[model samples]
Target: MALYNKRINDQLMTNCLALSNELLEKETHSFFPNIMSYWNHILFGDLILLRRLALNHIAGLTPQTLSALPTPKSPQDIYCRKLSDFAHLRSQVDELIIQYCTNLTDENCEQFISYTTTEGESITKVIADLTQHIFNHQAHHRGQLTCVLSQFGVNYGCMDLPIIVSEGSRANA
Candidate 1:
């Protein structure tokens, strides 16, 4: 999971960097208005999940720096006007996520995380499940971004996990 997450994040950062500023900011008819909007939403979602996991406070089992992250009120609240800024922030947060997942233990994965939703609803779930949700949520929005990009005739390239793994193995061989 950590490897897959890291690869996809690397791909996202690369793709964002390759896009023109105008392309990144182009408004679309999707739920997220633009590429930057979806990118920021993905970052905010990871930060929120990391902060919640940090509440566990188990030594060496939680992300120590997540407490300082700002809680975004909405997707729009987190959008970066500059593509470079957004890409840099995304890369940093992706590194943090990779670290968090790498350090996670089987025991820690089974523990429950309890937190209130942005809407003020209390909820609890296994840490592993929450981690899965975070990745799944990012993929959902990424799909939307690809659709928006397609409309603009921008091909973001292959995001398939199996293709990544196969390519990596071939390179290693």
Candidate 2:
């Protein structure tokens, strides 16, 4: 299970970086600013959730998550600055996966995670589902990025699951 999710994590990160690079190459900076803001906001939120999960402190986080997002004045600057942060964010996710995997058993796949969502809703979900959601959410916004890029006459490359794994997302030096 850990291996599977590890793959998902790597793949999601790779595909995001690839698509973001495509945007960069074609000078799609204008299309990037808004989506990148939302993307960074979501990634930062995921990191906060993982931190809570790591410490078993799930409550009282939603407000902090909502309040702590970085605000950028320029969209192009946001893209240039945020990709570095996103790379680190992906590494942090891998660290959490490794730590969680160490404690994982087949019986723990449905381990309950209870937290207050940013929307003020108390939520309980399995770790597996939460993990899936993070990746899915990344893909969702990436699709938004793709749409914007297409409008500017640039094309983002293959984002399919298989392409990510087969191509390998080995740590870039």
Candidate 3:
């Protein structure tokens, strides 16, 4: 799931990079306001959630390791104002997620995660569920991104997981 999400993110990043800065930051008058805004929100949310999960230090994912990652003050925080800058951080976060998942064990997944929400509400959830939520959250916002990108005539190609894996399998055969 993490690997497939990474591929989709890569595709989206590529499409975003192809746009001029003006268009990337153009006012969409949508909920996110612009392409960069959508990208920023995704990254911010990922970092925030991952940080909570990393608190367990599961699979050697120590909070100290992610200490360098920018801590967003809120969901709407824009850590990387430019798309290029966001791309760099996005790449790092994607790699971290892949590494984290690659080492996850069934035992780890069953563990409980207790973390405070962005709204300051305390919450407890199973690690497996949180992991699923991470990917799901990515897909949810990525869909919004594609919708807005479509308005600009950008085609992101097929995002279906099975299709991506099948295409990769065929290439490697």
Best model per TM-score: 3
Whole-structure CA lDDT of model 2: 0.53
Model 1, C-alpha of 77: deviation from truth (Å): 2.5
Q: Write the per-residue lDDT of candidate 2 for residues 46-92, one digit (tens) a residue.
A: 56555545545332223343333333323222323455566665565
Q: Model 3: per-residue lDDT, tens digit, 24-56?
A: 988887779999989888988888878888787
Which predicted model would earn the best lDDT?
A: 3
Worst 10 residues of 1 by lDDT: 58-67
Clashes of 2: 0
The 10-residue segment of model 2 with minimum total lDDT is 71-80
What's the TM for model 1?
A: 0.85
Clash statistics: count for each candidate: 0, 0, 0
lDDT of 1 by residue, 66-144 (tens): 5445655654566477878777667777777777777778888888878888889899899889888878988888788
C-alpha RMSD in Å of predicted model 3 compared with the true structure:
2.5
